[model samples]
Target chain A: MAANISEETLKVSYEQLSDLEKEFEENEVEIIRHQVALNKPLYEKREKILSELPGFWPLVLEQAPPDVDQYIQPSDSAVLLSSLKNLTVSHFEIDNGGKGDPRSIAIRLEFNENEYFEDAVLEKKLWHRRAKSGWTGLVSEPVPIRWKKPGKDLTQGLLDLVVKVWEEDKKRGPGAAPITKAKDYTPAQKELKKKIETVSMGGVSFFGWFGFRGFPISEEESRAATAKDRENRRLRAEGKAVPDDEDDEEDEDEDEDDDPYGLEIFPDGDELAIAISEDLWPSAIKYFTSAQETGDMSDIDFEDGMDEDDEDEEEEEEEAKGGKEPPAKKRKA
Target chain B: MAANISEETLKVSYEQLSDLEKEFEENEVEIIRHQVALNKPLYEKREKILSELPGFWPLVLEQAPPDVDQYIQPSDSAVLLSSLKNLTVSHFEIDNGGKGDPRSIAIRLEFNENEYFEDAVLEKKLWHRRAKSGWTGLVSEPVPIRWKKPGKDLTQGLLDLVVKVWEEDKKRGPGAAPITKAKDYTPAQKELKKKIETVSMGGVSFFGWFGFRGFPISEEESRAATAKDRENRRLRAEGKAVPDDEDDEEDEDEDEDDDPYGLEIFPDGDELAIAISEDLWPSAIKYFTSAQETGDMSDIDFEDGMDEDDEDEEEEEEEAKGGKEPPAKKRKA
Candidate 1:
């Protein structure tokens, strides 16, 4: 019986083994099919590129270039012309007094040499028209010529224009131009243009005049204007017309009380107060008196009337009521 | 004559004064009209809010919960429980052969202790039902319980379920249920569930059976598989019948040399010659001689027959032509 049982067990295991083998064959075929499907196209492209490009290695082994140097510098003419070109006159003013050929006319020019020279020369016609109306010109002497540390040359066009202008001025008539002496003319024009151009490039306006002209009001001047305004306002508030400067300076210095009007009652009042302060005062006084009369001065003096004893009583009441005030009584108080 | 000139000057000045005054009055009126035209309503709601809010702040104040301290504690039970409540167990696997039960299942449950405990017990029942219907019966233990820390009492419902399962097992008597010991029930169930959950999370197949459940193939097993694959390929290439592992080891070793046809000769010639060490030269020569007549001595000794001087001359010619032979010549050489 044991031998029979073993034989029967062997037969059952053989049947199981056949079934597993068939399954494994089918699975392996499926796996191979999937792998070929994934890799075939990739392998085909790799093979094609490799087979077609045999000599690619030799072509990649070629030769190459070497190294060198370069830089820049400015010419002396450029330096000189650039400085002179910077001198300029921008606008002019004339106080003609309604007559006499605009006597004492003042001219304002930008202080850059290059731009000023261009305006005066190549663009000379622009200022010449203005000059025809009888304004003489004056320019500040050029400040010491300082080249920009890394000196870059002025443009060829500007340099050419400066030379042309100088030639034209010389041809016009001997000594007819303000710029005289060949040495003085070239270096001075060049230096002036360079300084003016450089300074103007630095964003400064150069202003000068042949006759009297107002600079920007200095701090002292602004203060003087303010003081004069204050004095004028004070005189007008007192119903007194401000006398001209010829008036006795001592009389003007009199104390505020000597004013003809009793405006001295509010000496501290300014133009704002003079116009509206008095009108508002009576209404203000009325409101104050009514507040005082009613003994409801909470708006004026919030804690003044409540005595220390009253405060103590309030605190005690709060403690008695569980650290809170009774709502209606608190409201009334 | 001087008096007449002075009178004329005075007359002209007077006329100019009247004209200037008229122009000034006109300008004053124009300026006033311009000022009135430019007046605009200045009030705006956004501006009012910007000015009136304390510190002129922009965003509205948000009053959040006052007890920020509550979030800082590490062992807050409610926080742990809430996080666990959101915990999701998405899939599971049962340990069974193909005939026992379905391999996979998914679960979603709230954190109620009673519900979690009921679900854990029911999972086994579900597997049993599938098993009775001709599917594999996979025995799985319950999942391990994780908490904020160990030694904390299991959730009330989980503890209750453990007690119930233990009581049921005792009532059923020995061998009636898969879970036998009351002491072992909880941990066994936990370990099974955790394994299934871990495999499911990683998105890998969960194959469970015998002692090898969850055991991955070792590196040695992978190398053996690769070797088997190579042997199969060799059989396919040589058009030989692939043998199973049942082949006698002695016969298989002898078969390595039994290349009945010379089909493998061309593809493997270089590699076989290199692999045959000096000690194996006699055997290699015998195999080669037996494979063919004369062995084509001309092709075998071709490199040896070329004279050294001729080879040098050819190399010099190649060097003269840029040290690069054309692709076809290089291949032939």
Candidate 2:
């Protein structure tokens, strides 16, 4: 952003500027005065707006399903607060026109510290109605259901939009049952869109919010699904086909989309990893010893992934080797 | 903050309530549900308020004139963020209202790691319209001058609203010779009130903002005033006349009033102080040595208050005595 410097300037005497090393003299003062003239009242209005804020703004943001939007969670936002780049909590406040409907929040964000106020800040005063939810949200490109397919209910409309497209996907044989087989002929983007249409045909998608508290994906269930996705991804890459899972790869794909921008996760070798893990040996030994003494393994789950079978096998092996060897030593004793 | 428990009761089954051996399990769940019911709307509204807040609420509060009567500095406003409590720079935004009257801003604030959002945190909002210049201003209980002696203009109408009683303090005798004397007859509270009135009468009493930015009392100047107050108190108690300079005793009296709570200061003896000072000798020597080499003394201004007069005197005395005696004895060597 280039500064809008005015054509005319002012002068400063040497004595006046001496303390400040003749820096930003009266010329700056004049410029500032002109600038203030240009925009002083906004500063005044800013104070008024500040005073007008609802007291619960922070709480409103905090109460969002998983706290706030990624934009508000400075850690997750596209930009972080400067002054050495700290996180800026997304701040929001809802304006209810005397208990009226159509809820909307006035949102606030912090920009990169060096950015100008006009560029750095964002606020919307009007109360906005949030987008209606259906199967897989209508993102920003809100599909006009009536336009796409004339149906009474949004779900019916959306289904109408895609059901035929997907049912045809079932490529039925005459007098035989129908089945799904991904078409190679369709373009990748079209195929992908059709696939999404197929996945979202059944239930209402995006329950609580677009991404915050999803309807069908319970937190722990999501975790398990993620683990399955990771395993499936590994298996698929390895050419091990998992059957009947194609209809619901959407959850995994959506999960993958959550972390869209690939974080450059560099894997460090065991030189450092082993050194750190080895340093933990003394503590681990004491922990295992105590767990064995108390016969409690819940706290040691991560350290020892061994199940009862592994423990029993180890005991049997120890009996075969140590019991007989110790007997020979026992004769000497 | 008492919990509201309603008279109306609800019931549940034995199987449902049997978390314990016929204890309060059901009662707790019932009461909790009731409490949640009572408070859920408030919580919802709180979220709404949070969402409605001006983007720059915290910033505006940071700018308030400390008129809220809470003494929390930006650093000390209780709630500090924990990842750290490192002070982030304040952020602000101006609202122009498309260029309208009575401007405003939205401001934001940071909380300490553990503090909640409701703590007292506003300051610096006012572009304080300071009081115009005057000799002394009266606070509560403005005595009516007209009731005693009438002035052509108020001094009467001021007394009408209990405001202008202060504007007419200047009573000049026609052929008066200048005279000054501290009145001994007046009651102490009256005297104290008069003194306060005198201090506030000049150039916008609260130039900074109401209670936030007091006028003319630079932080250091206030400190000086407090010191002078302590000195004056000691002198007055001793019955020592400090000479008549009453008209401009803003330095001393104003200082005394600042610390209204009257902290019971008990001065510690110098013995412990000397012990602490003596222990620092080694570090001081090392510091000075390093400072001399690195030219780091520019950063330190506190330790070098002593002047050449004292050092020269010390050297001369040492030379006249120790040097002469040492030289006479050194002739043998």
Candidate 3:
């Protein structure tokens, strides 16, 4: 049947499939390469955070993932001085909570520790229930740490260590992907994004970025994970190291792998995805459509060196292409 | 650490965990039982729809899963008159898209065909662009439908068959889960749901319904899905179905299986989900939280038989129980 996704293109001609395929392959590698290069350090930080956060800041285990070691020990922070912005400490616990499995990090900062504390320890919990940008604090558990005396050298070591860790975290990691809530888009872009967000409020979901999309799995992943289900099934069949208790754990892993194609935004995307994307964001359609048409990415400026003069040519070419109905761009021989 | 997911009790009391567990176990079976009874016919329709829809609306193959047979002889519709509302046909296509491998169902409605036709097919694509109630349309391709002439006895039989199919579809089938765009929620419910929706817009997910909470996985389903995967894998191994071509499909299936509990709505719903749900839907929280406390579901009114008088008594009992923090409902023999 004739399909109309948007006014600009009533139907994607059958012939365009070849073009779309070519376009996808031509740029996917490079795009991924670029993303890899860009997100390499971030990914590393994410890994390190996964490893380090659980050991010291087990409360982070609630919001962030803990390595096997971290999970075993978990975080039991005695003095949790959160929201250190201008010394506005939120929650400080005497009996550090490290016992709970799969702990939740978000807690209403309580003032219960005031009675147990000495006169010198004046602590306040920051709710942050309405904290704006650049004001958000990390969920942490600095367990087993006695609040060091202000002048005590013992406290300095703890303070310095905490400082170093905090500085490292400030660099942005997985738990805080695109951290600090920095608005990267322009005002117009922000408005457009808001509109998109409003429109996409429905319970649309992508399962997880585990197997579907190559989301940089590390060596330290759980034994239940990393090992393929087939391998696990084989091990179980062989009567070797098949843990029954971790059935829930394996189920948890599958949950992460829920998304059909591991596509974060697009659901079951193909040419249909192209149509949706084109319809939703018509302005950006040219990049995908034109690229598909000319499987020759020779015209694509990955370097973005297209000058003003070339922009005019691009528009004229687009107009001429649009005039050719049913099929916009022909197969480049 | 103590997690306070509800205002009634800030932290999920340890004692309540037992009660909650009991409630979940007791009510879950019954809730699911109730659902089973209510949706028995719907489920049958769902099965029938899965079987028969592909025979006619194989275009649904793009959106729905293709049975093994559908992969062999796909739909080849010559004429498609879509809209039944005032014969306002939206997309009418002659050459249904079925040639491409692992085809994407997106089509372009040709204006040229309008002039060629006998002043009949004037179709308009419903983007649902402005027709909000949270809906939007995507263009699709349906092929291999044999066209029936307008006034032929043979066409009458075909039309009768189509009518029967449509009548079956009218009942809420699995494929057509609550069609016709009716508002299922009241305004207050909508507002509350929006709040819940807003709070739960993260990348959280659940996996297969296995052993976390009893998520209704009969022994039969596992065998079937596992066998299918094994068969599919075997086919690939034998070069009968090398599915590098459909990389996305496998992933999508995983996404569907993300929630370990497979709590269709709640993704990886632990305490975080509880907090969100409680904060958003306080009225619903009693069922979940109290369920866990008693491990006893005597309080649960699954039948909705508790009238206004019983509702008052329930409230009084709840209040009386509330005073006993950390120990709400005692286990009833």
Candidate 4:
């Protein structure tokens, strides 16, 4: 073992691995295509079966796997339990060739007549789009939940604020924009932000996730950033001058400091959606069945549990009582 | 949302969903087969590239993503850095058609001339087998490391005890035996257990993972259990008499109380192997490349950091400093 292992060797090896990784990614794309095709009938079958079982979706949410469950506030749970009629997850881009990502999904939640909202259906689309940093996952625009009354809003007004910001973002004409700075906010937006900050001191409601606009970078911007990153990495490997991402890092910190309502609502929204679509949706029947057998509907107190110091230990105890399992199922794309 | 949704409708819907889930699983299996084929040449290329770079595996281990890195002791790090020559992960069952699980992996570690062990290579094979609980994962019998001296043993003699116990298990005629009971332990076995308990107070070594025989249940037993569980669930759903698993749960607790050397060594061995094979192995180049540029060799202090109450906070700080990213990659199957 020598300390003199050349940087060139590592660079070459990394390049080779990157090429192999590309092949792996291509293989994944093919698998996603197949999965999209295969899931069509299963999803249809699921729809039929769920229709036969009233309160299926709501019950499933009550037993939501811990990751997604953490975001559900008491108010959100009440709304979902009372009104959520059907939940469907679909690969919306399946019909498109390679132009549209097959991993992109549409999550639709149908509601029966309820006091919470006027709309019968609330839908969110997540494009499996890449980020400037080369990481890729679900990206979406805010879908306003038409709350029937301010008192009935599960997000406690956070949803309205994010939706407003998103609508303002639409004026930028379909390109990636930097996260809105606090100083840049309109007076009304600032007032809404202040109100949301105070009201959502407990944390964002699960419904607020509908407003999640994953990494703000557009697809085109992401591609460019990815290319630039590659070039920089190559330079760094060669021990040549390479520009640092200090500016990007600073920007990220600034965005977090501002705590834009969308990001605040669900910083892990992309992953949450993935978990819901891939793990929770497919396994909803299991959760529903298990909850019914155990009579453990009272275990959905994630918001209260979040405030505890010994949350991990509390969760372990919950798991011991067969309350929930960590969402581990990842059936490909 | 009605409370009067019939149990029969729920049961029927569950059955349909289960059937749909099976289709999803079949699709997953197909994707895994394709991945296995696609990965073969890439792995071969990796082997070739690794040969050109000395100390690459050790360097990668130094930058091991947090989950795997947490198990590596300071002493283990010294041994690995000095002697670890090559690391290779392969799906051994790739050519076995449908008989063998394609997800089953063999992790091999080759050492150069070293003071720690006599063997040039240590290999552990994990069969992607199912447990009686219907959960499937990589399972293996212990692979003993031939340490040159007692002091050189990375597992602090825990491996030796497990190997003895495993040898004793071989005498039981190869059926699925319940976990070994403390009351049944031979005097020597009892003494060994005591010694291991005291010496391994710090926790199990990364090397200890080699002896991880997952779940301690045979594949035959698992299949039978799956069928029985299904039958029991149906019986329960029909409000008929169904045998409870309280006895099994008690047995599980009793087994844990005894702390069998194998289970004590690595309870999450199955998941660790999958993370290594699927996530770590593929991403080793990225880790190696980043580590070299950042010069962050000091960040691999997981074993020391484990004792602290602020371990999570410490990890966050480490991540902020570009120490390591949470292992998030899962290229499908």
DockQ of each: 0.01, 0.01, 0.01, 0.32
Q: Model 2, range A1-333, lDDT digits (tens) per residue? A: 011112221011111112121121223223323332333343343223323322212212221111012123232221221311111111122121132221112223323333212234422222212111111110111111122223223233332333343344335433332222333223432443454455444533211011111122222343355356446545654757756665355433543233211110111111111111221211222222223322333554522365434543443343322111111001010
Docking class of 2: incorrect
Quote the lDDT for A315 in model 3. 46
Best by lDDT: 4
Per-candidate Cα RMSD to the true structure, in Å, reads 50.7, 36.3, 28.5, 6.6
lDDT of 1 by residue, A99-121 (tens): 21111111222223442233332
TM-score of each: 0.12, 0.14, 0.17, 0.76
C-alpha local distance difference test of each model? 0.27, 0.25, 0.26, 0.68
Q: Which run of 10 residues does model 2 chain B get worst, by summed lDDT?
A: B324-333
Best-fitting candidate, scored by TM-score: 4
| Pairs clashing within candidate 4 | none
What is the C-alpha local distance difference test score of candidate 3?
A: 0.26
- The interface RMSD for candidate 4 is 6.7
The runs of at least 3 residues in candidate 2 whose Cα sits more than 4 Å from the true structure, single-residue gaps closed, are A1-78, A83-98, A101-106, A112-119, A122-333, B1-333
lDDT of 4 by residue, A1-333 (tens): 343487677666666666555555656677768767766776787788778888787877766666567777777777788878888887777664445667788999898898888999999898876555455556788888888889888778777887876777677678645456777766656766687668667887888788777666576766676577667656755768867676568556544555333234556567678778877887776677655754544565543444433444554444323234433453111
Q: What's chain A's TM-score in each predicted model? A: 0.16, 0.18, 0.18, 0.75
RMSD of 1: 50.7
Alpha-carbon shift of residue B42 in model 4 (angstroms): 2.7
In candidate 3, which residue ranges exceed 4 Å CA deviation?
Answer: A1-217, A222-224, A233-333, B1-146, B150-333
- Tell me the lDDT of model 3 at B285: 18
